[model samples]
Target chain A: DVKVTQSSRYLVKRTGEKVFLECVQDMDHENMFWYRQDPGLGLRLIYFSYDVKMKEKGDIPEGYSVSREKKERFSLILESASTNQTSMYLCASRTGGVETQYFGPGTRLLVL
Target chain B: AQSVTQPDIHITVSEGASLELRCNYSYGATPYLFWYVQSPGQGLQLLLKYFSGDTLVQGIKGFEAEFKRSQSSFNLRKPSVHWSDAAEYFCAVNGGATNKLIFGTGTLLAVQP
Candidate 1:
């Protein structure tokens, strides 16, 4: 079984503070993704990394960025956390040519 | 552009009753369809997937989904609903050569005792 683990299950930060959400996968999948989920809006992609040091912006990438320094770890960074940035953040990893993605238990972020 | 739509936002079903959640997609070619379940405060879990060959695919927790090419629909169904089955269900589609998945606005299911 593929196991994706997130660094934090819940977090709270003040406005304008920097926030980091970490994700690690044991399967060494080539693709890693960061998504923010909201009510009635579903899961919207924030950023994705296809390989180490390679990143692409997804649909909603305005206030978010990503880092993939190693093969097994992906991190999402918020330059300046705002109240609107509070959301349930999910991390997923999948191998190339496979459509199935395994997800980690999400981090519920609260930016006050 | 490929998109997925889940019409029903919330559904209520009694325990031991039948349940169905609708999903429709718009893609140019054959699409990869998936149904995922998210429990409260948890990440999404893959319930089932439809790539090819089989129209009706079985998934974990006694759930199943059928893909109808004619209608562009991949609806999920369960013969008997349990209280523990209450969760938010999402439908997603992967079309073309992209690894990205377009997810639908999820449907929250409520199981009554």
Candidate 2:
């Protein structure tokens, strides 16, 4: 099984604080993605990295950024933690291309 | 532009009953279709995907989906529903050559005793 692991399963941060959510995959996938999931709206792409240090913005990337310093690790950074940024964050890695993506357990972020 | 839609917000079925989840998509040319399941707080897991070939695709956990080009629909179905089948299901369509995926509002499933 492809194992994608997130650094933290639950996190709490105060407003204006910077938050970091980390993700790692053991499958050596070339593509890594960060997504924020909300009720009714589902999961919206935040950022994605195709290769090391290469990132692209997704549908919702206003206050968030990502880092891919290595092939196995991808990190999501919240510039300033706001109450609205509180949600479940997911990380996924795909081996071949866009077809199949394996996901991590997910991190529940609470920006108070 | 590309998008996905899961019409049923929630569905309840008996443990031994048949299950079906509807998914509709909008995109130009042929689209890559996928169904994923998220159990509770876990991340979404790929259930099955349809890129071409057979319209009906078999997946893990005894699940299957059929794609209809005319209707632009990919519906997931299972013969018998187990209690463990309860989960939130999401439908997604991949558009762009960059691997950006558009997902639908998920459907929550509840299995009755």
Candidate 3:
């Protein structure tokens, strides 16, 4: 079974603070993604990494960035957290050419 | 551009009743379809996927989905509903051009006793 784990399940931060959400996968997948889920809006991709140090912006990449220094770890960074950035963040990973993605328990971020 | 649409936003069903969730897609050719379930405060879990060869695909938790090429639909069905099955279900499609997947808004299911 594939396992994807997030660093924090819930987090609270003040406005203008920097927030980091970490995700790790044991399956050694080549593609990792970061998404923010909102009510009635579904899961919108924030950023994705195909390989180490290679990143691409998804549909909604503003106010968010990602890092993939290693194959197993992917981190999402908020340069300046704002209240609007508060949402349930999810991380998913899959190998190349595979359509199925395994997801980690989301991180619910609260920017006050 | 490829897109997925899940028409029903919320559905309520009694236990032991049959359930169906509709999903439709817009793409140039046959696309990979998937149904995912997300429990409250948890990540999404893959229920089933339809790539090719099989129109009706079975998934975990007694769930199944059928892909209809004529209608561009991949709807999920379950013979019996359980109270624990209450969750938000999302429909997604991969167009095969890229690794990205387009997801539907999602349908929240409520199971009645």
Candidates in order: C-alpha RMSD to true structure: 0.8, 0.9, 0.8
* Poorest stretch of ten by lDDT in candidate 2 chain A: A93-102
Per-residue lDDT of A1-112 in model 3, one digit per residue for the tens?
Answer: 9999999999999999998999999998999999999999999999999989999999999999899999999999999999999999999999966469999999999999
**Stretches of candidate 1 exceeding 4 Å from the true structure:** none
lDDT by residue (tens digit), candidate 3, B3-23: 999999999999999999999
Model 3 docking tier (incorrect/acceptable/medium/high): high
State the C-alpha lDDT per candidate.
0.95, 0.93, 0.94
Residue-wise lDDT of candidate 1 within A20-99, one digit each (tens)?
99999999799999999999999999999889999999999998888999999999999999999999999999996646
Full-model lDDT, candidate 1: 0.95
The docking category that best describes candidate 2 is high
Q: Where does candidate 2 clash, by residue pair?
A: none
TM-score of chain A of 2: 0.97
Of the pair 1 and 2, which is ahead by TM-score? 1
